[model samples]
Target: MTSHNPHGHALASHTLPGHDHHAAERARSVADHAAAVVELLRPLREMDRIETLPLSQALGRALVQDVAAPLSLPPFANSQMDGYAVRSGDLSDGGTHLRIMPPVPAGSSPQPLEPGAAAPIMTGAMIPAGADAVVPIEKAVPDHFLDPAKTTANTPASTAGNGNGATVRLPGTAAGTFVRSVGSDIAAGERALAAGTCLGPAQLGLLAALGLAEVTVFKAVTVLLVTTGDEVVEPGQPLPPGKIYDSNGTLLEAAMKQAGLLVRRAGISTDNPAELRALLRTEGQGADLVVTTGGVSKGAYEVVRQAMADQPVDFLHVAMQPGGPQGLGTFDGVPFLGFPGNPVSCLVSFEMFLRPALTELLGAPARRLPLRARLSLGEPGGQLTSPGHKHQVRRGSLQPDGTVRLEGGESSHLMHALAGSNVLVHIPAGVTELADGNEVEVWML
Candidate 1:
């Protein structure tokens, strides 16, 4: 069940039942094969340990420890508005008048109030020692000072009696009015942010309110990418005869970036055995994982198989359209993943296999784009008629009302089809036909 690559490397083999022995065995089922690959890679998975990071750098990072408030929010009974701070006992239904004291601005120490007097206080100012309530400025009358010219002309008998009797009146307010008490929003030692939670804007604000300047979070992983093929050319280059632009490399790198992996390198290797082997050895040095697209099949120019002849390479033909070929093994103590060369196939393989496993390893939630909808039209040739394998993926999209529309021709080489699609319709194998209106499971892109 083993095959040799050009570099004398023995690729891991699987036996197909008496069919084209040249072609790799189709997987029994796409889901089964995907699960098996995840199991195989479980041991090599690693997540960075937690580190305390400043608040400025903690955005979008996963929290590693629970955060508790060290002190009560507000920390003291304070004024909520610019007004008069007075003792509650001085608040009478008929309005109590008290001599006005000096103004109390915010950030200054509270001045002790006379037993029945009031003090003018600004918003956020601390309440005086004897004050229990605040009455807004609108509720008080301003005192007029003496003016010699006006007073001299209006010096009447009644004015003289009431001249020195001028006093300010206060409105009736209940105790504790306009006061933000200590621990009103949060108490000391209260749990503010739970462990393992992903920090978002609101959470970050709450942490800041709790006086946290730093937090501990897990580090992101790093990945190395390799795409192999003799006919593949970099983008931005003219497509010469007998060669196609490399799409899988960019596609895989973007996908890995979305999964929180730092893509260290994305280089291409031609179908040369010696060059591929040397590249693998050189790139495997600090890479946690090495991913390759194309040249793992039984074709003669399959450079990935030819180059790593001495290393372990599992040639898997999963039961899935567009993404049936795969290679999984280790190269120089680093995990290796190989996918088919076709652009659509590479993306499909990533969505179906790598994403879920990496999510589990990184303690991230299993996030997938999936939708349920009725088929827009009848796909008569849609089902897989194979006897052994059971699962296929088809490019699809959702209509405005949730109907599923199949897009593009079912060719693996068609990158346009993959690009235009927003979903992957998963149809189980052995189902000969699905009627036009049948409900189906769709994975969103």
Candidate 2:
């Protein structure tokens, strides 16, 4: 059924049937589900704060504004190789000998090339004004000059003649050959990187080449992580009967970190609605988004649903597996997302929804993607899927042979299998099974 939030935005929630009795009419397509999520997050992206980060600390940050090159790349024409700098005209007739001028080291300045003269230049050294091309030292015939530091027109090896004289025979070359021209890579005042570009090593290196010490980037989206369920306990804590360690909180925190989001742990809330409501009020203040796990499913103790009853949060049963039950709303005016309690479900939800939306919204490069892998098991047929759900997430391990093998059953609560698996095997809706060697999409962890 469609409901309107406080902002008058459309909200959709579907009633899920049992696995054996799925109703396709009530299901939502994965694409549609994802679009709905992006819609909710669209406003958040525009609301992102802009900040300046030093180049040293900007790695992995997304740009908030376009960056223009302050100066042309290479700034000046320079030698592309350690060779003899000569006027292309001097060698136009074929191999001809020219007297070698002083050798130009990388940092040293050299006088312009004169008629019938050649200057020995090192790679990256400024090309003398009158020189139009460079002949690599190895490509030049005969004359060997002393090191640039010791060579000059007066040196014994720097004389004019054929053979023994400081004369090198260079073949005719085209103008600009082996010469790196200014602004070849990036012109001055041209855009170097677009807004929303994620700054990685290559991007940062590009900025460094342009002498940019800092960059303007959107502030990393801050995620306030709150996990629900009283049965969940922190890792290493005493696990009393019927209580499992809270894995969703830890899992999401790490996942958010990898996605470049700043994560804050608000710890786990019990199945108490009043307690969860209080926690949301306190923790949701400054966060760009708030995420909670569990307490939105059909269970009687759905604390998140009860706590957010008066709020804009809509508890949804999205047509996807391992994470069908979902939640989206505004908590204390901050966007909030509630994921299933299952470890695998929580992670899969983030991958299918939050990651993709954030990538577009933040202009960050997509960090995770599903890989096509053949099912390792030579099943008699394809895998089974929820009839109504358009997507299913299964625990899997990517095998060395380039296929992903299912490691656990389809049950969402199976954490052991989830822990053992290195990837999430995805099965699109309506597929009954796949014969051996059939390719399937898997999200590598």
Pick the TM-score winner. Answer: 2
Estimate, for each residue in 226-262, the C-alpha lDDT of model 2 and write its tens digit.
9988888889889999998888887889888988889
Decoy 2 TM-score against native: 0.86
Residue 4 CA displacement from its true place in model 2, Å: 28
* Whole-model lDDT values for every prediction: 0.72, 0.79
Show where candidate 2 strays beyond 4 Å: 1-23, 92-94, 142-145, 148-165, 365-367, 378-388, 395-402, 414-423
Off by over 4 Å in 1: 1-50, 65-206, 364-366, 378-388, 428-432
Candidates in order, TM-scores: namely 0.66, 0.86
Error of 2 at 28 (Å): 3.2
Error of 1 at 256 (Å): 1.6
**Which of the numbered candidates is closest to the native, going by highest lDDT?**
2
lDDT of model number 2:
0.79
